[model samples]
Target: MAGEPQPSGAPTKGGWITFPFLIATMAGLTIAAGGWTNNIIVYLINEFNIKRIDAAQIANIVNGCTALFPILGAILADSFFGSFTIISVSSLISLAGILLINLTAILDTLKPAPCENGLTVCMAPSKTQLAILYTSLALSSMGLAGTRFTLATMGADQFDNPKHQGVFFNWHFFTMYAGTLVSVVGIVYVEDNVGWGLGYGLCVAANLIGLAIFVVGKRYYRLMKPQSSPFTGLACVIVAAFRKRKVFLSSKSEDYWQETHAGGTKFVKTTPTNSFKFLNHAAIITHGDTTSDGFIKKPWNLCTLQQVEDFKTLIRIFPLWSTGILLCTPLAMQMSLVVLQALAMDRHLGPTFQISAGTMMVFVMLSTSISLAIIDRFLLPTFEKLTGTSPTPLQRIGVGHALNILSMAISAIVESKRLATARSHNLHGNTVVPMSVFWMVPQLVVVGVGEAFHFPGNVSLYYQEFPKSLKSTAAAMVAMFIGIAFYLGTAIVDFLRKTTGWLPNGINDGRMDNVYWVLTVIALINFGYYLICSWLYEYQNVEKNELSSSSPCPC
Candidate 1:
């Protein structure tokens, strides 16, 4: 009977062990690249004399590039190369860019002094050097976008049976966060002691190692060949609509429009010319009445339109998912602006209490890791047992949004206290705030908790809603939203800095605690918006059941 059905435990054939290893390797490399760049924001402010706000803007640019290129990567991966091949090629390209950045540092070190007026002095690199640095950053950003979605999808493909799919997703998220954990410690060491060049060089080395591992595991991968582009999907919908119009107009009797036996199977007969003409004319139907011909036609392109309509309908039902965008804005701020604030604050870790910007990040990472594990392994299962139904991904996301608001509220309180401390001490002139940096830990921990709930839940929701052929594209959409949030946050911060005459005083002079409060307020407003959106979301259990019954194959 169907060859004894595939086991629910794991894939029996092929090298499944290599799959998780491959995913972990890629995750480590991506996290290293991301963390190294994120930490550079602090380095730029301290060493390059860049303003905190300006540094944040630069970081936004990097995030934006990474986000935008994913659309391109998704298109290529879906329409041209399979995910495995695309990821392999993209990883190497990213590695090359990282190496180029590292080489710049080596060049600087090797440069000799020039004699001018019999006094020897080392000459600094020109503006051209800076331009090249940015170019390399852009390349690396593109590489990241190209591989992020493809690799995730590829990892999921290793498990083919539906019963094993849940476990696969659990591991996928676990591996991603695990990679971020390694980066927090590894990149911090390179940046704090070894220098920026060495840190970036290490990223290059890590990426190369990841690429090699993936390549070695090629035999174990179950590759899905690329399909037609999303544009093709759209075109098919349009064509099907027109064809249905023709079928509608050809039949004239109501009986013809009713279900009838055709080829020993029931088929719905449709009206002829009138239905086709009606669609073509875009005539507004104000009343429900039988046509003169007594024939009626259902809407054309139901299959394609249903897919698009379901997306729109699902969006309307869950307002919270959309509002999560607001929560995402502050979340994005953590890696850039929030970190900058920490850098300007005193970070003295005594034997009993320790606080550093990088150390705070470890807490954030740990919180994220532990929270995700709890949710996937225990919380979800327990909830399912009680509710008799697992919570929809959108529902999970809504909970995360609420937690995000809490995170921001904590941030506001902490920053208010820090601001008061600065004002009381008349320590306004110092580059670093005099207050203990440990005050920021609560907010950071809250952020990590929020992320754990949101990121994986949102990803699962997007994948479920997307058409099977467009899974990568759907994943890219999720990434795009995050990129947009960062860009928008940067824009708002820039506008506020210019309008309030706070640019030079806050960012340049290092009294940015006030700016932090402003972000906190923005996040609260977003939380309110998120609540409104969440209220509108509808759980589509029926549709999900139908799809699952029809297609037994797991995504």
Candidate 2:
């Protein structure tokens, strides 16, 4: 709380950078990032001559790396530099990365020559070519990571009212998904039909424009000053608690670390809770913990009461977070494999019109975008009108779990049918199946709806439940979960390829139905685990009166 900056204008967040400008900036960046990433699998396969399964694995790895970088951005924004500086720097970095990718796409020497045949006999990129390709990928990934989630936090920073913040979140997600939908559908089509050079060039232009918009509006932003992270305090609590493990905790509030008016600072004092009794030792005033003047001379030897409580909050919600990992892994798996499935399936809507394989996931993006708007406008209001309360985060996430399981089951059935048609034509020998690509839509739509329920719900839980000091990083937590799921999906794919014939390079030749079935089982089990975690966990921030009309007020 030290050295907090004064607000610039009225409640509308400093009155300089308005909501529309920030939203526009976010949309542009989202479009730029999505355009390049959406069809990365196809690019790797066609342009680099990577195997189908290998391309999918690499895609997942790229997804994971890009998603994971946001945590570091959040940490820096909250702990060192503010969002404006970090965002500006990140935007430039991202612009540079996109330019590099565009260069590779434009210069033939940077890539391998076209395979006279197909990938079966195509010349792979040389070590030098690979180094340039990887460098471009890494730079682009880093650029994407720096801005994606940080933009969310920055957008929320523009509003004063909690209600306005909530509205911003909905619109933020809506814009992000909508922009991605356009990229996956429109730009990906360009990459698929027109050319990679032109497609990547569009992304570079988009990134440049986005960064320019953000920098122009920089002075108007309401900047939140960075303070030392409360996680440091939490760590101090753990260290002090262990050091004084044998020390007994007292019931007196005075025994804890709360600032008594001594012309220095102000801090609220509260009695320790009964739930986490052992951690109370950190707050217990003892011989060497405090100075003679009553201040904590050695910080590592003591902690504030809030620090202990904050640590407890994390422990309570981690199980819920853990369960959602598997929830997301199935979707990640579906996303990568579905592209490969589309590549090998009949994509013609008519003799004249054919769908690009990369554009198939646009259905998922569209479904999520529509569902977010509907859930925000109609579903939540209708539920509150019926039940006299909004749906709890757990309730929303629970619905996501059920829908995810169903999506996996649906995916399994569709794949099974696709395989059956492939076998009927004796199409295992390098032949594309006759099954319609439209068959992939149902499962994608279901999973998108699930994401609609779960993604925001999980983010809300983290922000509500996390300690004040950790609020900045709370948004990044969801991004980190997504990254982990992508990595886990990669591992699952690799394991299946190495162990069994269920995941051959060609899904038509392998038993893809079994892979989906396995994903379904994993989802079901993780859903059960989520239920248990939700049942046992308590909310850290929910008001007592609000709890009455919905779930039990356990906390």
Candidate 3:
């Protein structure tokens, strides 16, 4: 039923044949994206002579923009060009942006001179240089927004069977993690040791190759045409209800206007539920609301029962969704803060080898990749065997909340120890702390493990609970919330800088430990809030029994 070709302009029949192209493209694009973004703070500090705190702020904003753009890209795809066109054009845009970045790395004139030996002060870039850099970053972020999750949606669209879709999603995530791992470790190493120009040039090449691969697979893709935006349908329900505010509520199934399937069967055979009864007005049939054949004549004044139900579903899930914003904010802050910490600490792996500050996230990626395998192969099966039921997505999310709180506490403890060591040695204002960067590994690994549980759980919960028409948007929702969290992180950082001595250009002179402690407290409060929301939440589309039996994989 899922794989069959639809009526003219809908997705056509496509299957596993399209997997290699999409997967390969995802891998290349991810690697290319990481090549630039992973080491951005270091780049700004070293090449552009920006202060460490300012560079971290810029990195947060770039990360926020990159995450937020997907919602817009999804809207455009669902409303106008469709996924194939969007992905293709976006890849080209990314390639162009990367080329510009590479040029900046190659041409010394495009950047301010590097700070001279043993000097804290450095020259700032000119306005023209800043403009070039900003334009490149904007284009790259926009390109990334267009392709990232849309590719997943398009790949899933190719398969008709749920099992096949599950396998595709697993592979999709695997490829993505692998790409990021390689780029963060490998590409960052190249940028730090070899040359930034060569590092960004590789990114440009990867983007070109990935784009070519995707285009070559055009014939194999089951391209879905742009349809009316699901967002529009949801808005119509609200508007229609407001206009019919004085109308009496009714429980009768026959009172509401229902659309028919192709075979003349009612699209939504059941009457509206009592929950959010105000929205039911949108479906109440009124004189002249529809034509003789039951088609809507006044789109804003009338909606099908299905549209009303979809709006209600989103409303029901709003509280649970809001909790994720706060839950993610601490993690976003930790991500950037850890980078600054890594920059100021010892990163040696051996006598001749040194780890790049940006590559410190490799611990998180490595832990997540390994933990996902362990969960899928060991923990999940063991839990099901012991309890005679699989763990629910909410349960997984709850576990993640606990782990995140613990991770923040660990980070605070480690930062305090690092600060004590710095003070004892009188290392204030020094570029590198006397402490080892590996001291940060435990917290990084803990948070990565937390992500292993929560991210997939959130994805699964959203995809399963969202209305059928909004499945693509469901995939992008995670990105949207994470984007909001990054913006919040930026605000939190700015607020702290203005009000406290927790962050400075040189963290060695500031109370970095205090920042981690504050984050720990915030995470603790957020976890409690998550517990309350999860407890109050009830699954609408998925039964508890069904949820307990479903695979923990995102699909």
Best by lDDT: 3
- In model 2, which residue pairs have backbone atoms overlapping below 3 Å? none
TM-score of 2: 0.92
| Candidate 1 vs candidate 3, lDDT winner | 3
What's the lDDT of the predicted structure labeled candidate 3?
0.84
User: For residues 386-410, what per-residue lDDT tens digits would candidate 1 score against the true structure?
Assistant: 9988777666666777777677767
lDDT of 3 by residue, 1-555 (tens): 123246898555578889999999999999999999989999998899988888888888888888888999899877888888899999988888888999999999999988997886779999999999988988898898889888877898888787787788778878887898889988888999999999998899889989999999998888887888889989999999999989997777778978756744374547998888899999898888877775778999988898999998898888878778777888888888888898879988888888999988888887877888888789999998999998888898888888888888899899888888888888876468778999999998998888888887887788788988898787688788888888998999999999998798878888878887788888888888888888888887755422222222210
1 against 3, candidate with superior TM-score: 3
lDDT leaderboard ranking: 3, 2, 1
Residue 382 local lDDT, model 3: 98
For candidate 1, the per-residue lDDT at 346 reads 80
Off by over 4 Å in 1: 1-17, 109-126, 235-321, 351-359, 381-389, 503-517, 541-555
Higher TM-score: candidate 2 or 3?
3
RMSD of every prediction: 8.0, 3.9, 2.9
Q: What is the TM-score of each candidate against the true structure?
A: 0.77, 0.92, 0.95
True lDDT of residue 442, candidate 1: 82
